[model samples]
Target: MNATQEKHIAVVGGTFDPIHYGHINLGRAALSALHLDEVWFMPSGSNNYRSDMGIRAEKHHREAMVKMAIAGEERFAFSDWECAQPGSTYTSRTFAQLNATFPEVTWYYVVGADTLHSLKYWEEPELICNSVVLLAAGRGEQVTSGELQATAQTLRTNYGADIRFIPWEDMPVSSTQVRARYREGSFAREDLPPGVYDYMTSHHLYQSLEWLSDQEILDRCDATPEERGYYERLATMLTPRRLRHCLGVMHMAMLLADGYRNVSMEQARLAGLLHDCGRTENNALNALGHAPAGAQVARRLFGVKDESVLSAIRWHTTGRPGMTELEKVIFVADYIEPFRGHMLHLDKARRIAYTDLNQAVTFMGESTVRYLESRGEDIDPITLETVNYYRGLLKKQPIPGQYQ
Candidate 1:
């Protein structure tokens, strides 16, 4: 169907916190079934009531996600009409605006099965009923198909609304489930639409304290029940983006710990997870970087009694002269975690890390020293001293049981 020749169109509106395949599928089904000339992914939500509420992503972000989700689909378009509007929005007013603005087009408002049953109770049901046709995605979990058809008939009789159901067996994904998985640090690459996960990771969309109560956070730590509060506090301290990085480091540290005899997984897990606890919006504007401050915070506020864990967190940013194996694990993991795409020597260090611990630290130190020199930046004396120590240590002998 040509856009210029179009007479029929569908508007799929919701919060679309991070539009996923389920939403894309709904639009696709609408275009195919209704022979729609165009399907607009118009995000509609009131600032008054929201599923994610205050922590719900910014409207621009929601709009960007909708735009990204519908890209390359000729019939699928993104609409910022309602989302860009100021203040609370009612569906009736929104559709009325569309009708008045583009009277040539016949509009079909797309919604889920749950919304299908509640159409009349919405503000100005007659205006909504008279303005557009209703096309509901068939989410038949809580409510049955017979119930949806019955509700559709009731709406038609009472409000003179035209409601149609698309055949959706079940909605495989929901924003709540997606947010839960993100909070747990367990969402897979396939769980979201393309670019959505990367966008979420970049923006730190769902890593909030509110996203998890959080048993999910406790489970994600892979820690004991006693350590739950520490992880919870950690979640609250860092920004959402930083919290994700911490989880990545914690997971990577655990992976690296498996290869070394001296390193304990529990110790590595705790150290990696809390390595950045001192980070905040202000710490002398990052003049007091996280490493040393983190150790102090770990001991005082979090009550981490383990000196090994404290030492690991302390020197993670600046490698020390006589660093322990666990220290190297946290340091290496922080630098080489999977989420880091911007740092130097990441792939080489990551490869060498699993093979030889001593050589990995040596590589990390030497490369950082060189990068700092090339940039004409003031090299930290401790960093130079630590690099020298690792170089000399590499010459002397390899530590026992340090090889993968």
Candidate 2:
């Protein structure tokens, strides 16, 4: 086969709700093994197999994410033809349409080994198998050579399918795992393409209260049923004004985290959102601080088990000495969020946040002290300790860990 003798096109189709690295690896593997000129990512609009799955995003969002995911890959392109169709999407129908459009090229369907096993059950399975050469890739620890050989032999004998198993190291990533982590407030940007991850975060996709209706919100939250219940309760518990403030804090924390590499944006957002969970009419002036109270509520009500996230929420309002990067981000974001409304030097504090995290923390702590003194309110000992500690750092001196 000369380099330009045949026009070989590989087609990788999936729901791709938020395409991860694993999907990209599979397409790359197929392209290399089959010598395909390009890989077309076909994101199905309404998959009959996945129709019962509740976590699917809308067609436009999925399509957008897919585009962002494959932006820089020269050989990768996406088609909206399947998504534009109404009703359940069948692979056979897509293959028919693709063949009609590009009759000169040889189409290879790239899929996982699991999908290969279930291909016979798809609508008009014979038509699908005969239309394109099936290129099945293995998932980590799931597909075996013996099983793959048996399945391919059966398919070839039964339906005259041109099946080939492209062997490569298995990738453990999956969209389900990504969605689960997002709901648990632990999604890492490394699991996805950088552009796709940024798009999801900036748009607040897969978060609680971002969708219409409680059920839709719960569905998109990507948490377990029990965790979803807790989110619902929290939504009702906080006043609308307070909830808006919490959201603002979350966004601010994420923005600040970009400058501080030690802190995770996801953890910062979670801490900022739950920082005021304990503030209510009953506990507005309680002797027990809202920070600690919010930590307790987060543990008991929201099932938060991450120690760093809990600690960040626990000390967001009153900064403790020797705080972690995430703690500093949440503490600063809570003070400087846009909705905080009318504070002296707030603009300076916001500017310092991106330039120097330590300075921002020190500024917020000192401002809090001065504000409390002016109002004749009691000063928290820990707040003073934090201010002094950062001041010591600014002066290049060691301060004893008195508040730890």
Candidate 3:
């Protein structure tokens, strides 16, 4: 409340669905780069960009995640201002209200580099420009100095916008990618803050094989009576971590199957959920020791008589040649799903999964081959066969341990 000393405030707004280290680092960069007094994380309740942001965790979940991630950071804080708005609120409107509430404090808006480019197109860009200085950080998003400078100039020339790009180190992770990784049952421990991942695990965030109550999980997956018994047994038998992985694969497979015409979403769902039914047996022998056994387990134990589901589970590990669409889906889903984020080139594989499912599988195969070769381990004959079959189909050239 010191009228004499000037105070500076900056606001960064987004879904922050599962706020990660990138968001935190940007706030830190802003503080160090712009010499701001404090940075506020404004999580949007429902914005115009909601649909494009992919699946958003519930408003309260997003808020809680942000709060949890920023707990130790003194300069960073969470605000529910936009989330509390009546409807789709604009950045301009937020500033008007912000100024009205804190007239004396000078406010700045920290925009992502891409968002900064389109600032002139936002509602009342002129008023927004006049209200607060714009700060864009290139911590996670890709934008060259030349591009940022050009965009900043355009904003200034067209709308008289005050914008600056702060010094930042690029972080390769994104929330959507993080969510996908979680849904797949894999996450890089480094992507989230210390306690946040644990929180997500305990709360079953991202639908990554969340350890839900038996009935709730069965209901959510639309499990049949027979399927329910198997799921119940699996829930009790498998470790929490393994079960979560299975669920993430199931959710991811269904998601991947949604884009394919030939694949059965139901088959994809079941295959994903039970892909690891024989994981213990698989681990007992070779790396892929469980694939064939998993299919038999699905039939005898789980009662998944649907050959498509069983076959998908069978090939989920070491993919085979002449694999059906459902087989390809489960194989690729197990590789690129959220829980499998640790795999190399996963983002690329995930991106291509929707467009060209076969190509994504090849990419994953190449990565696996490369990784296995690096360790001087014996390559599985089926895995090499699967890679060669898909690679030949796609006309992809040979790589080490591939096409042999």
Candidate 4:
């Protein structure tokens, strides 16, 4: 690399709630795919959500934790960008600040495969893409070139930017799973990255009362037994009808993800199984939203922090204008679950998953939009956007036949 000319810079930011191997793999992949000079591991601080939690460690403590986690990595360096910002930080702002500091360096914002799908929905997502290349890690059945092309077209048409999709097939481990295990008091040192494992053990992270909430839930679920024989028994005990809705959404969402050719079966299944866990009270469906509830459950019970999965569950019921494939999968699956009542076209929609997940998901989205329209329900912005997003793709590359 020339000394005078700036090198490519890839920024990988996360809560590091206890960074793990997956994070390291993502950082390394970004460097190779973006052809960058270095990758920065940025830790967040005092954001709107974290600030409210009152559980995030002090700035120095968190930074020290990050330092400990990345001690031996030569290619990875820590940047306190989110921590330095005065308020809740956004990706666009972070990219701009980093670019201003190193104007000559080409920038790429590294995100998981799920986050990349939902990038269009982020605040000022267009500018963020324009400012830095968007790199994604992992694969599932859901991602397809058509989907990427659709997302690219949306960015170009709406934001005047193009994003490069780097398919990453790295480790499948998730921070959320780690968190869930931690919450349940079952997480071991083996679950973390070598460096992170060392840091957690030395400092004793995730062993507090705050994280033990899920243990109580696990206890309750284990205690309860449903009367239904097998599937019913599993559904009622492992995943309830209401929870089944979330899982069905997840199952369909995974198929949708498969259509995109990026979502993995394993990741989707896990997301499906855990998506509706936050919805504790079935009767309170219209009252307390499920995402926050599910997210709380995930953090306490399941330990999910993939952000993509968390965001999917959080926004499933009231989808915003733009969502990733994973998010759409969870959202649409809830409505189209095989066991759910009052489905618009359950057979048609369900069949689409086996043939063309995109078609199925688009059908689910359109049906959902129409269903809500008929009932005068408040339509989720993202649900509409997801419909439109697919409609745009369907126009560009129509499916062969009506999904069987």
Candidate 5:
């Protein structure tokens, strides 16, 4: 094949303990600049250069994250060549193995300018230099264009290495920053690839829940002193079991609020904490009217003034039609909190609540109707109204104002 038709592959290798946008950008730039057919991500199994950086994630987890980060890009692929090796892997050895495996394909190695400057210290620098073309992307302000050119000329003169520079805007993201965010329980979905973030949440990586204690949950709430005083007073009125349930609901409500833009975390916390304020037998609130009673108690006792929070408290048990976002949050939290005992379809309800709030609310309403019917109990009129309203929403039909 002529040069135009020849297979050109760029290899991008790194520790990639947790791949971020910087890594993805480097690969994409290499593909565009070098006219390469594909970019392969090689996550290092072990790095001798950074052995002092503390414990790294297992090879499988690192590989999984890389796979997720690169997904949906047909030109991007990954290799387990370094990860399959038993001990420390050198760049020279990796280059040699790749050359042997794809001798007909022209190879280019993508690296940051910082790594290019440190090339002399890596194992068998001359072999690494000769193995493939080096494409160095500019890093932060530390590496200037003049400095990169000078260094590239030196390597070309001394080691016969073909080096090219690619202009790259510095992205303020690193695996260390990602890990720190995960540990602090403040990691946002935008910081990482969608699939990678989903995987991290599912696998519970990077101490995701280490900050989920009762105090930690409360700390995340942006509550004023008066609101906290209300929380303290409400806690004293419940039995131990009921108190635990309330805390769990508060935690779940905060989590749900994080996924939606309109829902406020503080509103969710206050509404969740007081949703069951009237559940006490001594308080004279029953199953049929506990929600309305709780709303009154929230207004009279805690001085809650927000209509949304009061409406959420009033309708959490038997949801009304056309509920607000805060109302939906409390309603879903009460059903799916971690402390809630086993209930049919609860797991699916929790998943739906996080993924799609409206769907979860409708599911809960329909499921409750079915459950009450199975038990031969009278279905509450408000719940029937809620079920009809959301079902109408799902079907894109206009609901009557009476239900609203």
Candidate 6:
């Protein structure tokens, strides 16, 4: 093989504020599946949605930690191009740059099923897809064969793209759970890649970042008069089962927020605990039109104005028009909550949630669509539209004449 043909690389990139096991697993899986020559760990300097104002570690520190976490993985190497480059880092720009530098090499972008769903919204999305073959891992929320066929048929009639759903090994390890363990000071060596725990300890990443600690946020939420009032009022209104599920969602949200470093634990807990406050016996919660109801509850009771918190409440059930990071977190948490009994798709959501926000959003939204389908419930138009919007964003080829 020529030099250009010889180079086959899989790029597994993330913020790596606190690199953990899930990331390593994905890299290994991608490497094995693609038979790639190498997998590079590209730690983003900062995410556009998750800015430096709340970032606990500097770019150099985060990159170093990522380097240390994957130190022993022979196939893994670290790159800081995104961190070194000025301005917000984008995947299209990153891929364009890579292609420019290594025109002869074959590059396969490894992403979760969720990320694959939101390709259209990305910068130069169509161009990006044309440049490389995307390898997407299956998620918990993926539609069943019948549903997929129905949806695919609908898309085929509408758009001339073929949505190839790849079946891959599922990984349940989540960034959220890892962050929670770190916050409670209970993260074991096994929970993370070797040396990551020590790096976090030496760097004091979690302790310094108050929001990274879940217990602290829970304490803060309990201490805050507004959070307290909302909790107490909801306690009186909701049944014990609903309350327990809400608690489970909150716990999961806190874990996810901790893992991503995009939003605070306080925000996650607040949003997660309150996302379904509007859920009432009048409407089966698994039914449609619950998000707006939850939004109303947030406004009427707590008087919250922050876009992230309110958006989270509004889109937790069936997503609304536009969603923010906190909103996406709550949405994903509702679908992937630790308490879910029949979840076989945990790996898919976890894969995208940490690395890409848009992918995470699509994953949860599509999961919502699939969940309603499984129960023989009516599919809400807004939710379906939301899924379609993200599908467009991901540049996925629609199955013609179906689900349009």
What TM-score, over all chains together, does every model reach? 0.49, 0.50, 0.49, 0.47, 0.51, 0.46
Q: How well is each residue in 1-404 modelled by candidate 3, as lDDT tens digits?
A: 67777779998787787888888887887898877888999987553122211244445557677888888787888898887643356888889889888887799888667677777778999889888988777753456567767878888898788777776775787898898898787886666986778766655555523345535444544556766666777877578777867766765675565445356767887888888888762356455878888898889987778988888888887788888889898888788665564788776677777667778778887788878889998778888888888889888765554446
Q: Which candidate leads in lDDT?
A: 5
lDDT scores for all predictions? 0.73, 0.74, 0.74, 0.59, 0.76, 0.66
Give the per-residue lDDT of model 5 (tens digit) for 1-404.
46655688888898886899999999988877777889999987562212211133435557789998898987999887786663357889899888888777878999987787799999998999999999888754545567777888899999999888776765788899888888678888888875878766654555422234544445434346766676678768878677667776776776566445357777887888888988875866567678898889889977889998999999998888889989998998888876666778987776677557788889998888888789988778788788888988898453343434
Cα deviation of 255 in candidate 2 (Å)?
29
Compose the digit string of candidate 1's lDDT tens values, residues 297-349: 99999999999999999999878888898999898888776557787877677
> Candidate 1: misplaced stretches above 4 Å?
1-6, 48-54, 139-144, 209-404
Count of backbone clashes, every candidate in sequence: 0, 0, 11, 33, 0, 26
Q: Report per-prediction Cα RMSD to one decimal.
A: 19.7, 18.7, 14.5, 16.9, 16.4, 16.0
Q: In model 2, which regions exceed 4 Å deviation? A: 1-6, 47-55, 139-144, 208-404
Model 6: how far residue 397 lies from native, Å: 50
Question: Model 4 off-target regions past 4 Å?
Answer: 1-3, 48-59, 140-145, 201-204, 207-404
What's the CA error at residue 137 for candidate 3, in Å?
A: 1.5
Per-residue lDDT of model 6, residues 77-185, tens digit only: 8887786653357777787788888887777777665665466667776556655656665654573445545644443344433344445556676655665678788
* Runs with alpha carbons beyond 4 Å of true place in candidate 6: 1-5, 47-55, 139-167, 208-404
- Tell me the TM-score of model 4: 0.47
User: Which is the leading candidate under TM-score?
Assistant: 5
